[model samples]
Target chain A: MSATCHPSDELLVAYGAGSLDEAASLLVATHLALCPRCRAEVGRIEAMGGAVIETLPPSDLGADALASVLARLDQLPGAPMPRSPVVAAPGLPSPLRDYLPASLEALPWKRLAAGIEQAILLQARGIRARLLRIGAGIVVPEHGHGGMELTMVLQGGFTDSGTGYARGDVAMADQQVVHSPAADGGETCLCLAVTHGPLKLTGLVGRLVNPFLDL
Target chain B: MPDKRLAVEPGPGAERFSDLLSAVAQYGDRQAFALLFQYYAPRLKTYMRKLGAEDAVAEELAQEAMLAVWRKAASFDPGRANAGTWIFAIARNLRIDMLRKEKRPEIDFDDPELVPDPAPRADEVMATQQSESRVRAAMSGLSAEQTEVVTLSFYEDTPHAEIAARLKIPLGTVKSRLRLAMKRIRSELGDDQP
Candidate 1:
């Protein structure tokens, strides 16, 4: 199903402008793979980018610039016409496919608690992206965020504060929101989550688990 | 000396560039490629400079972007995008790779799981075709404040928060301004397809 919840227009604009950090970009790209609406939104923004470029006054390149580029054109091999399509891995979105193995079952998951497991996909520039798998009917410890946290459900669903998020839905949380999300009893919920800063666990169980969690 | 006859002037229209690009794709037309290089290389360099690249690096990246245009011309679909939009995407991807050295994972159009957009009406198809001019016209209509935010957001490498800081405004205001600007642009472009 298409996502009901999406990243804010501002966030999608940033992604279109190519200003978002790598981790955040990855999560949004994965979401775009599942949401055509956001893809169309980004396309319009990119057309604006083209308009911006068209209006920009030209800068002066070196006098030999054209000559030099022309010289090198002959040296480079001709690329095949109409570029080949990439073979996407089954059951995974195209953006996430490269970072993950073929199947979720093959992931080397690290258990954070009795029913919660996480596998970090990437960490760079203070942004961490991970796949979170919460067992059915389990409640994650109550937590606030140090900065922005973006979660997109990949499989099954979860609920927080009367809001239901199923496959392809995104949940955006920041320092102001302290929530304990529970996975639906139907199936284990698998999510791709990217966080800009540390998640602050606030509950007594969370406080106890935080010391060992390193998240 | 290079043949002076091959130097085609970049005309004052976007469709002409699209045709030139198509010629480059159909046959290895060096003259058409040269005209494109003449028009776009300098603008691409300016784009790089605005993103904080030094002169040398900007020049190199601009050249690289042009080289990529030559290599990837066959993939350019004139029905979907004009030359400027296609080249902007190329330059943006190159910046992500060469400047930031970060991976911006992309959706594969061929992926089976991808949700297809609703079929477009005949008028929607026409609007899509004229999106370049529509965007330019809409951009001209933006308020000066909205224009500044839109320009800086696209041209500068700074984050939205930084744009707020630079403008001495709150981040919320920056976001709202951008949202309003996009709304205006979208309305003008008739982009409310959904």
Candidate 2:
């Protein structure tokens, strides 16, 4: 099935141009693996970018640029040797498989609240990526973001502010957005969330616990 | 609607450059790489500067990107993308990696997820001497405003807010313009298929 919800076109274009930060790029790549339509769109966008580069006026490199590159080439690996294709695990997409634990059960889940668990994936240079597991019917604290936050649903679904996001859907929120996301009924929700900055808890209780949340 | 626009051809030197790249991949020919570098490095530096890089950083990254091209030549496929497209992608990827300020583990281009689709859709292939020409024709169709936002977005280090400020437009407007431009370009490329 096609993804009903996708990252905004601007985000995808940023991705195609290779301008997106690492955390955001991972979220988009994971979604692209599950959504063929988006994959095709990205392909076209990249092609368009290559086209623009062709028409741009050429700029001359420094006189030694080619010499420097050629000199460095000898120290670096030469041509890529042909190798067997990597076999991906059953459920995880090839890109995501690299970051995740061996299996769902192998995750090092840490308790953040009742019915809520989190596993920090990668944190570097002011950006953070994590996996969150919220039991069915659990409500995450209502909060706003300091910067951009991208949440990609990996399993089951979640609902926030009257919108339902199923597997492979992305929920993009920023400082201007404030809402409590609740896991949909039945299976627990597994989501990969990446944030550029810390979140600001909204409600009074949330604000009180905010100091401890460190999210 | 198949518009009556004729395809724009890539410059005369692209095929020879492609052959040079193939030589580098097959035999690690330094001379072939030097020829390819002479043609692309300057252009890649210009491309990087347009994306807001300073001259020194742009020069460094252009060299680094070409080095990557030398190392990854075996992964390049002429059937999937032209030499211009392949070199452009290498530069663009390097730009993004530099902006992130953290060198990620070396990404393998041969990964299935990373490879461009091996076959182009029949209608999307332009009736031109070079595949890159069709893409250029499609880009030429974008409105000036749309093209402005698109070009600015390629500056990997510049945030959307900075782009909006530079263009004297609201941030949301920049995003909306980019959205519209991308859709039009996609259609122009004959990628409107469902």
Candidate 3:
């Protein structure tokens, strides 16, 4: 099914403008793989970039830039060979395939709590992207975000404050939102999450577990 | 719609570029490729420069972007995107690859699991003919504050938080401006079809 929840227009604009950092871009790209609506939105945004480029006063290239490009053009094949299609792990999106193991069961999952496990896929420039697997019917500790956090469900589903997010649904949280999310019963819920800053777990349980978890 | 049409005349120049790219794709026309290089290379250099590349690196990347255009010309679909939009995407992707150490994960069109958009309407197909001009018209309609944010966000590598700091505005304001700007642009493009 097509994704019902999407990243905000602001995020999609950043993705189209090439301004989003690598980890965030990976998350948004994976969502775009399942979302045609956002893809169309990004197409319009890129067209705006083209329009802006057309209006910019030209800057002079090196004197022989055109000649240099022409020289190299001759060496290229008349037409580029069609790229071989990428083979993603079953049930995994293509964008995530490279960063993950062949299957979810093989991931180097580190336990964060009795019912929670995570595998960090990438971290850079204060941003982190990871995979979270929550045991069925488990309620994650209530937490507030330090900055923007984006979570997209890859398998099963979760409910936050009475709202359900199924596969391909994105849940965005920031400093203002604090809630405990519970994975639905009958299946382990797997999610790909990208965060810009640290997450602050609240309450006594959170306080006890917070220091031990490196999230 | 009439006012938008008046604001920006249909870009004959844009259509011409599309033809030139098609010629390169169909027959590997060197002269056509040269014309494209002449128009886009310097602008692309400016794009790289605005993104913080020094002059030499910018020049090199611009050349690389143009070379990519030639190699990938066969993949260019004039029915879906005009030449400027197509080249912009190429240059944007090249900049990401060369400037950033991290990989930019992209959707593979040929992936078996890929979901496709619903079929387009006839009007939507016709809309591609003047998409660049329509975008220009849409851009002109944005407020100055919205335009400033959009321009910086597109031309610079600055993130939203950095843009907020640079402009001395709150991060929330920056996001709102972008959201409003995109809403205006979308409405102007008549892209609100369900």
Whole-model lDDT, candidate 1? 0.83
Regions of candidate 1 where Cα sits further than 4 Å from its true position? A78-89, B1-9, B120-130, B190-194
**How much does each candidate deviate from the true structure in C-alpha RMSD?**
3.0, 6.1, 5.2
* Tens digit of per-residue lDDT, candidate 2, span B1-194: 22211122224435456666677777777777777776677778888887778888888888888888988898876655667777888887777677556432223434564433334444324323236666677777888998888877766454577789988999999988888887776676654444
Which candidate number would show the highest TM-score if scored against the true structure?
Answer: 1
lDDT score at residue A30, model 2, on the 0-100 scale: 78
Compared with the true structure, all predictions reach lDDT values of 0.83, 0.74, 0.82
- What overall lDDT, based on C-alpha atoms, would model 3 receive against the true structure? 0.82
Best by DockQ: 1
Judged by DockQ cut-offs, the docking class of candidate 1 is medium
Task: For candidate 3, give the lDDT of residue B42.
Answer: 82
Output the number of the lDDT-best candidate. 1
Q: Over 4 Å off in model 3, which ranges? A: A77-87, B1-12, B120-130
Which ranking of candidates, highest DockQ first? 1, 3, 2
For candidate 3, write residues A23-59 as lDDT tens digits.
8888888888788778778878888888777777678
Question: What residue pairs are clashing in model 1?
Answer: none
- In model 1, how large is the Cα lDDT of residue B156? 57
